[model samples]
Target chain A: MAALAPLSTYALRLGDDALILGQRLSEWCGHAPTIEVDLSLANLALDLIGQATHFLGVAGDADKLAFHRDALDFSNCLLVEQPNGDFAQTMARQFLFSTFQELHLHALASSKDERFAAIAAKAVKEVAYHRQLSSDWVVRLGDGTEESRARMTAGLDWMWRFVDELFQMDELEAKLAKGGAGVDKSELRAEWDRRVDAVLAEATLARPASRRPVLGGRRGHHTEHLGPLLSQMQFLQRAYPGAVW
Target chain B: MQDWPLWEVFIRAKGGLSHRHAGSVHAADAKMALEHARDTYTRRMEGVSLWVIPSAQIISSDPADAGPLFEPAEDKIYRHPTFYSIPDHIKHI
Candidate 1:
C-alpha cells in the first residue's frame, strides 16, 4: 500500500456517504411532515453537503468525485442508498447512520494529518446535532402512540437489514486502520450497539434478530437503488457540464 | 406521530455574550427543540451558543409594564457608563 492512498480512499468513501444521504434528505425539502421538519431536513442536507465539499474537494475530484462519476466510482456503503421509506424509516436510518458517523468523526478529529483532523473537528460539531436529532425522533415515534409506535417499529425493522453496511470495511479501510488515519470500525461497533440498544429500549422498538448482512458499497457494487439516485444526481451535472449560476 | 411543542430560540454570539432572542421553530419534543434551535440560529456561524425554551413556557415583559417597570431606569444617570471609562481590553458589553 502506498503512503496516503488508503487514507484518501477512506476519505472519499465517507464523503460519498455524506453526499448520497444529503441528496436524499434534500428530497424532503418543503415536503417534510411540518414546517420545522422541512427546515430540519434542509439543515441536515446542508450539513452533509458541506462535509461532502470538504472531503471531495480535498480529493481533487469533487465533480468526478460526487456528481460526475459513475456509481462504481462511489465508495459509499449500502445503508445510505436504502430508500427513504417513511418518516420512521428515514429516522431509523438517520439514527443508525448518525450514531456511526458521529463516532467516526470523533475519532477522525485526532487524525495524524492536520487537514483531516481540522475537517473532522468542524464536522463533529454538526454530526452531534444530527445524532441527537435522529435519536430523539427514534424515541418520539417509538413511544408516542399506538399507530406511531407501530409505524416506527416497522420502519426500523425494514431498515435493519442495511445496518451491517456501516461496519463493512473495504481493502482501503483495512489498510488505513493500520495507521491512525482511520478508526477501527470494530471499536465503533460496541458503542454503536449500546447507544442503539438504549434508544430502541426507550422507543419501545425491537432490534431485529440476527439476519443475513448485505455488503458491497465500499467497492461500488450496490443494490438497484443506487442507479436511480445516481441518474437523478448526475443529470444536471451531465447536462450542464460547466453551467454555473 | 406526536405533536412536539414549539420552542423559541436565542443565540449568544460568543462565550460570555448575551443571548438575544432569535426566532422560533416547531419540534416533536424538547430534544428536537435544541437541535432546531442550533440549526436555525447558528447556521450562518452567527452564534457560538444557543438557548431554547418552549414557546409555551415563556413569560414576557409587556408594553403595559414599560412605563412603570422600565421608564424609571431611563433617568438613572449613574447607571449609564458616561461617568466611567471602559478599558480598551473590555471585549463584550
Candidate 2:
C-alpha cells in the first residue's frame, strides 16, 4: 500500500478528540448526580476510549500514541478537553460534539479506504447513541425548571464558539476528501445546523448569536485546559515508563 | 441534584422472547429513563428491545402477607406434576 501520511494524521486527530473527551467524561465516574447517570457517563467514556484505541491503533502504537503525546502533539479539536464545568455544561459539550461526530463518522463510513471506512462504520453507531443521550439531556435541562433552563442556556453559550471549528477544513482534509478517503466537513455544516437547530427548538432554547470561531486545536494550539488534563491523563505512564499491571 | 423518579427496566434479549426484568434507573421522565436503562443494562447489546416503566406506577402485594397468600398452596401436592408416577412401560412419558 502507498504511504498515506495525511490520512494517518486525520485518524490521529479524530483519536485525540475522542481520547481527550473520554478523559473528561471519566472524571464524572463517581461524581455524576446519580448512580444511573454515573454509569451512563462512564459507559459513554468507555465508548469514546474504545474509539480512541481503534483510531490510534491505525495511526501508530495505540498505547504510545495515547500516553506519550504532549498537548502540542495532539490534533484534537478544541471543543473537547474543555473542563467539565457542570452537568449542564458537560451535556452541552456532549450534545454539540457528538452530533458533529455522528455526522462526521457517518460520512467517513463510506471512505474508499476500507479500513478507515470500517472503523468509521463502527464509530458512527456509538456516536449515534451518544448523540441521542446528549440531545435528550439538553432538552431535559433546557425545559426542566428555571434554574436548569438558565444553566443549560449558559452552558450552550459557553461552548458555542467551539462549534464552528468542527466543520473547518484544511488542505489535507480537502485533498483526502477529493480522493474519497475523507469527509468534506464543510458539506456537513448544513445538516449539522438543521439537526442542532431542531433539537434546540424542541428544548425551547435559542441558538447563541454567531461569534468568531475558536480554531487551532487541529494545529495543536489548545486552551489552557488541555495542559492540566494531559498532566493527569499522562501521569501514570510518565511516572512509570513501561509499567504494566 | 434533581432526584428523578425510579424506573424499572426490562429487556428482550432476542426476537420472539419475553422481556425479562433487567434492573432499574432514576430519570426525570420516561425518555431519560429509557436512555438511562439502555446505557446501564444494554451496553453489551444484551437486548433487542427495552421497556422502562415508572416504579411508582406498579402496585404489589405486601411481602408481609406471603404466609397467608402462598403457604396454602405449599401443602397441596396435587398441584405438582411430579406427584403422578409413570408406568414402567411408558417410555415417552
Candidate 3:
C-alpha cells in the first residue's frame, strides 16, 4: 500500500477529470457537424465545468487549482486529454467517460462525506443525460451507413485502451473508500462493462480487444497529449496572472 | 448529414399547459429528433414536456387560400363570448 493522500487530493482528482474533459468538449463549440450538435456539446461542456467547480471548490480555490496547475500536477485521466479526433471519436470518448462517470457519481452519492454526496447527487442527473446522448450517438453511427460504422469502430478502438484506468484503485482512493468518504472505483468495473457492452451490442459494434491498460494519470503522470492541452488551457491565466472578467 | 429530415419541436412549459411550437431540429429519426429537440430547446429548463414531429408530416393550408380558409370567420361576432356576464368566482373566464 502506498501512503495515504489527503481527502482534498481525492477531490482534486475528480475535479481535474471534469475540468479537462469539459475543456476538451468545449473545443467542439463551433466545430461540431451540425448546429444542434454544437449546442449539445457546449451544454455538456458547461455541465462538466460546473461539476469541476464544485469538486475543485471542495479541494481549495477552484480558480487557482484549475488555472494554476501544470500538466504534471493534473491528475485527470488520460482518456479526457486525447484530442477530439472526429465526430465519431468525440462521441466514443463521451460514451465511455460519461458511462463511467454516471456510475461513479451514483456511488459517490452515498458517500459519508456530505459534501461529496451532495455534489454527486446533483451531478449524477446531468451525467445521466450525457451518457444517454453519447450512447445514442454510438448506436446511431454504428448501425448507420457502412462508412459510419467504420468510423465508429475506429473511434471505440482509439478509446478502449483508456477504459481500464477509469476503474483503477489507488492507495489514496482505497483509504478514502475504507472510510466511506470515497468510492472504490474498481468495484464499479463490472457494471461499467455491462452498460458499455449493452451499448456496443445495440450499436452492432464489437467490443475492442482489451490491451495493456494505460495507467498513471492518477499519479500526475500523463501521455504527451496533456501538455499541449494544459498549455492552451492555462495561457490566459499564465499571461495575466489574477486577470478576471 | 444534410439529408437529415427537419423536425418541428413543441414544448409544454408546465403540467397544465399545452405544448406549443418552440423551434425545429434536424435528425435522422423520431428518437434522434426528440433528443435533438431536448438539447436544442429545453437546455434552460424551458419545458417539462416535449414533442417532436417530422416537419414533412405537418399539413398546412396553402397561403394563397388564406382568404377562403379563414377570412369568413373574422366577421362572426357571435363567436366572441364577451356578452356573457361573469360571476365573481369565475376569475379564469
Candidate 4:
C-alpha cells in the first residue's frame, strides 16, 4: 500500500472520528426518548456527518473513505465507537467527547493549514452546541432521582477508561504540531479536565476513578464495538458497489 | 416523558419579524424547553429568536366565545384603512 502524506493522514483521523460518532448518534433518529430529543440528536448527527465530509474530502473521495474502510483501518478514538447504551450513557459519551473536541477544534481553528483551520472553525460552533446539549443532560440525570444518578454514574464509569486515549499524541501528531499544521492534543487536557470537572460538580456527580487507559484507535486498532458499527454503516455501499442517491 | 410539561414555541423568523407560534415541545423545565424549541423549530434557518412558554400559561380565547369576541368586529370594517386613496408608489402601506 502507498504511504499517506502527513496532512492526508491527519484529515483521515479527524474524519473517522466525526463519521463514526455521527453514525452512533444517527441510531437515535427514531428511537430517542422524545420527538424533540430525536430531532436534536439527528441534527447533531447531520452536523458531524457534514464535518466528516469536509475532513475526508481533504484526504480523498469522502464516500470511498467512509464506506470502504474496515474497522481496523479507522482511526477514531474508542470513546465514539462505544454503543449508545441508554439516554444517560449516550449523553455521557457525547459530553466527554464533545468537551474534548470543542477545545481541540478551537485550537485547530488557528492552524497553519488553511483547510484544517476552515473546517475546525465551522465545526467548533456545532460542537459547542453538542457539548451544551450533553452537559445539560449530564446535570439533569446526575442530579435527579436516585435511579438517574446511579445510571449516570455507571455511564460515566463505562466511558472513563477511553478518555486518556483522546489526548495521546502520537509521533506523527507531535511532528505536525511542531510544524504548526496540527494541534498538540496533550495540551488540551488541562482545560478539558477543568471544564469536565465543573460540569460534574454541578451535576452532583463524582468523577469516575481513573483506570488503566484503553488505547490504540489512533493506530487503527479499535474496541470490539466498532466492527459491528462499520458493518452496518458500510453495508449498503459495500453491497451495491457505487450506488448513488 | 409523558409527564413533562408542554411548551408552546414561538419563533422570530428574522430581526424585524415578531415571533409567531411554530409548534409545541415537551420538556422538564424552561432551559430544556428552549433547547427543545431550537431543535424542533429552527433547524432550517427559520428563526433568529425563540420564545418558549408553558402551554398552560397561554390563555387562549375560548371557541365558545367566538361570536362575543370576534363577530362584533366583522361589522366594524371601517377599522381597516380601506378608504385611503394612496398612490401606487407607496408599496407597503
Predicted structure with the largest TM-score when compared to the true one: 4
Query: Which candidate number has the best lDDT?
Result: 4
DockQ of 3: 0.81
Q: Candidate 4: deviation at residue A174, Å?
A: 0.6
Instruction: Flag regions of model 3 displaced more than 4 Å.
Output: A1-5, B84-92
Weakest ten-residue segment in model 2 chain B by summed lDDT: B1-10
* Model with the higher lDDT, candidate 2 or 3: 3
Question: Which prediction has more favorable lDDT, 3 or 4?
Answer: 4
Question: Candidate 3's residue-wise lDDT over A31-129, tens digit each?
Answer: 888998899999999999999999999988899989998887888998998889989999999999999999999999999999999999999999999
Q: How well is each residue in A83-150 modelled by candidate 1, as lDDT tens digits? A: 88788889888898999999989988988777788999999989888888899989988888898888
> After superposition, which runs of candidate 1 have C-alpha atoms over 4 Å from their true positions?
A1-4, B1-4, B58-93
- Listed in order, each prediction's TM-score against the native is 0.84, 0.95, 0.96, 0.97
The alpha-carbon lDDT assigned to residue B14 of candidate 4 equals 92
Candidate 3 chain A, poorest ten consecutive residues by summed lDDT: A1-10
lDDT of 4: 0.95
| Per-residue lDDT of candidate 2, residues B10-72 (tens digit) | 999999999999988888889888888988899888999999989998998899999999999
* lDDT, candidate 2, A55-142, per-residue tens: 9888888899888888888889999988899999999999999999999999999999998899999989989999999999999899
> Residue by residue across B58-91, what tens digits does model 1's lDDT show?
9888989899998898879898678777899998
TM-score of 2: 0.95
Docking class of 1: acceptable
Q: What is the lDDT of residue A113 in candidate 1?
A: 74
Q: Which one wins on DockQ?
A: 4
Q: For all candidates, state DockQ relative to the true structure.
A: 0.38, 0.78, 0.81, 0.94
